[model samples]
Target: MFDIQEELKKLPDKPGVYIMKDANGIVIYVGKAVVLKNRVRQYFHQSANHPPKVQAMVAKISEFEYIITDSEVEALMLECNLIKKYKPKYNILLKDDKHYPYIKVTMNEEYPRILKTRRVEKDGAKYFGPYSSGFAVNDAIDTLKKLFPIKTCNRKLPNDIGKFRPCLNYHLKKCLGPCQGEVNKNEYHEMMRKICSFLSGQYDEILNDLKAQMEEAAEQLEFEKAAQIRNKISSMTQLSEKQKVLSTDGQDRDVIGFSRDATDLCIQVFFVRNGRVIGREHYIFEGEGDEEIGYSLSTFIKQFYNNVQFIPSEIVIQNEIEDSETISQWLTEKRGHKVSIRVPVRGELVRLVKMVSQNAEVSLKLFKDRLKRVDNVNEEGINQLMKLLELEQRPRRIEAYDISNTGSSEIVASMVVFIDGKPARQEYRKFKMKSVEQQNDYASMQETLYRRLSRAKKEKEENIEKPKFSDLPDLILVDGGFGHVSAAQQIADEFEYRLVIAGMAKDSRHRTKSLVYNGKEYELSAYMPLLRLITEIQDETHRVAVDYNRTLRAKRYTHSELDEIEGVGETRKKALLKHFKSLAAIKKADIAQLMEVQGINEKVAIKIYNYFRNK
Candidate 1:
């Protein structure tokens, strides 16, 4: 095993890449850093000032590797490229891998159609940005359609001289009347040229032309045409001026960036396609971290581009990164064309970089705020459980099981997953105590826990590469005070997995009074809330097992008043259960609401309404 602190000490302050390898030397995380000394060292520090989530990541890191770069910008560039190549597990990544939209112009035909494209390819087509906001891009498309109305359909016009109607757009003064043979080669070509210039942001000429057209139409007594032209000009001017934000004068390039606070993170990205702010979107991240602004941008860029098919030609960034060459290399290789990255010092581009940095700061702050309570678990209690059970690691999600039986008949087991301080009911499981041969109390507990833990261990071994809730527990909370705890301990010890085994003991009044663990009894009732929580969890688990046993005895059938209605079977029964979760919820569900479930169709809904109405 490699010494982690020694590896941390070897990290240089220069810009570079770092890889976090597990005990097996599997690369779990790969990151680029402008200041290796600061970033790498932060992970090793034992400061209670850190967020619990960050602390958790630090605890899991066993070994690491690094490569120093000359400049921070180089580090940024390299980090993004590496992230794309090796998708790290612990990184603030873009979820739902989608590239921003691009304005694509294809050279596949003499007459090219301008369209919004998600994927960029090598079929002789020029592509613009990967837009973050689909709504904004759609708005741009709507505006373009109103202004120019290029062929919206994917069908190519037959080159056989005269085929197909120009459609409704030709008569509406939308399309250049291309269908009526009214537009000559020169006239139609001129419209495309004007569109090219307008989209490219040389809008001074567009305003001038619209003004001239409005004036000419008004003088010729064409008031409607003049009004139409005037409205188009006004819309164009307002659209250009709306996003008159921080650095609008530069050559069009999408500014993609992300930020995090405590609770959640948001990645704010904008598409500056053809020098216009055409699209923008923000992706919400649920984790917390303390990585610098540049490193975040690099990580996001790599992760974003890894799954997305397109890359812009010029990516201007907040941090001039060290990994610039590598990222550019990877992107160029992907796009089959060269891409460049720059960190400007003085011009509008530099201001744009600063603006992006500011956005990241805002985003990170939001992330931090949300996570302040999410993963703030009771480490002492968890560690105590871990030590008592003799487990390998602290359990993030623990499940405790107990068997309940009415003599030898209604034997069932209840399983619950404790997430942080609360019960994660979604992960709660139940099983019937089958194959136990006899209905002995100790044997029943052993049977139930053995089945649960054995299955969990098998899952952990099978999915050793991936950590999941199926792994063995940190602690097992048996329902009985002492007898159940003793029974559970033996099974865990038999499997050679250290686990904390405890039981919630209740007084004669069914009130939780003490916890029995490893042959000792400790009163827990003094902590009213903790005691109450434990009792509720224990009761819920017991109830769950009893209910499962009842259902198993019932055997593949559930009788409900809802099922008495026509057209209601297992599907509708389950639907009613899911919608309502209980009989009370079903009673509250009105006819109108009941009709909302799909299979209710029409006749069934009416029957359900009357049945409930009469009942």
Candidate 2:
């Protein structure tokens, strides 16, 4: 282990970089910061100011390494990159695989078609929404079909384009006669154009024209056209009935309304086009922040549209943003037309915003209520963590750390986040060991915490992100009994602040142990659900980290020794290792059964068969 305090003294106060290593000299973490001195020095602070776990992390600082940076923003960008590359244990990692699905309507086609998609690809199609509920999209599609009569089958019109016979949809009157061509091509195209216009945020004009035509057709003895228009009118009427109308005038406008409790934010945007509420959307963001509800709403809308390719003509804001004029100008220029940003002042617009606000409020309340019995993590938990840390307020979510290394080789750390009184699995992190030389828990903890907290600070200083604790955490739980907590404490003290730190002391069996608060310890069993929850968190975090550690170790071991030949991935390697119970047995097995493992494909089986055939 290296001398950590001495290393901290040597760290440049100017903004730059920092590196952390474990007992075996393996680089467990890497990060950049604006102020190296204050950031690096916080690890050796008082235990009372930290959660028992964090206090334990602080105690374990064997060594720390740091570099300087010119500004916090640069540090932030650099930090995100490094964390991504190394995958440190403690981080607010943005999940990369999942995506929101949207409904796309290609209005430009001669006959517009609706499609389901997970992303709004730039194929010149109009995107309706990122509906989180599959049932919602299904229902909307069904309802829309009733009004528009889009073809539900894969048949073409009478030109033999692909028509076989009229499908059930035609019999059910839910589809225009594309199959039999009882409907003229021109008339069908006209219907498609009308649907296209409605989907493209121009419903009022389409509705009005249909009404006028319906009246004129009835007078001109065109009963069929009049009946068709009448059906369209009825469908539109039913849709309008389901909607909570926000406005009635023909103002091509869009309104954004939102609500947020201390830990979550929900925004509802009503798409009011031509004086009627045509369509709408809702979004929820759960993360760290300090902005009040109104300000949060403002920031959200701004960031949201910053990435938006389409800017509506008129945007009705629920609250004022500081750079409204600038943003409005930018949007107007992009739109190639005039754009107005307004916070409605006591008219129909205000009434609309209020309605949206009420809806958002209800949505948030519903969400909170749904999560109520799950785990009650409130301000008190945050305060309790904060007060214990000797800081200002309790942290709403606390991130804890511990590095698990079998020796100098399999170094890794587990990061577990406790939100309210429960764990937020979405926020948990795992770090694979990197460029460090040896195994050292103290140094590893130091580096992991340094990277996590410093990056958080960089976000705040640069205005790209608010302070993590700005939303704050209640406590930081460290995996080790004492060393990890002490290292965390030192880091806090150096920052010249108090944060509740605690150590999760594990038993000799490496199972659920107890908590060390201040200079004393308490059994985890006394906490019941909380204790059980913590154990699960601790166990999960440990498994995640150690599993990664083993993976890396195996990767190295396989490439260097066991997997000296071709035809080996994780699963194949596992089968060979397990069935034979050793590399030697696998090397000894004949080709006939060498290909018998579950995942071993024929080609791979042959390769394995051949390699070990001569072994």
- Per-model TM values vs. the true structure: 0.49, 0.42
TM-score of structure candidate 2:
0.42
Off by over 4 Å in 2: 1-98, 153-190, 213-231, 241-364, 371-615
For each candidate, what is the lDDT? 0.67, 0.64
**Which stretch of 10 consecutive residues in model 2 shows the poorest summed lDDT?**
89-98
Model 1 lDDT-worst window of ten = 524-533
| Cα shift from native, residue 29, model 1 (Å) | 2.8
Candidate 1, residue 320: the lDDT equals 56
User: For residues 4-56, could you state the per-residue lDDT of candidate 2 as single tens digits?
Assistant: 76666777768766766656665455655557887666656543454333344
| CA RMSD of all predictions | 18.5, 25.7
Say which candidate scores most in lDDT: 1
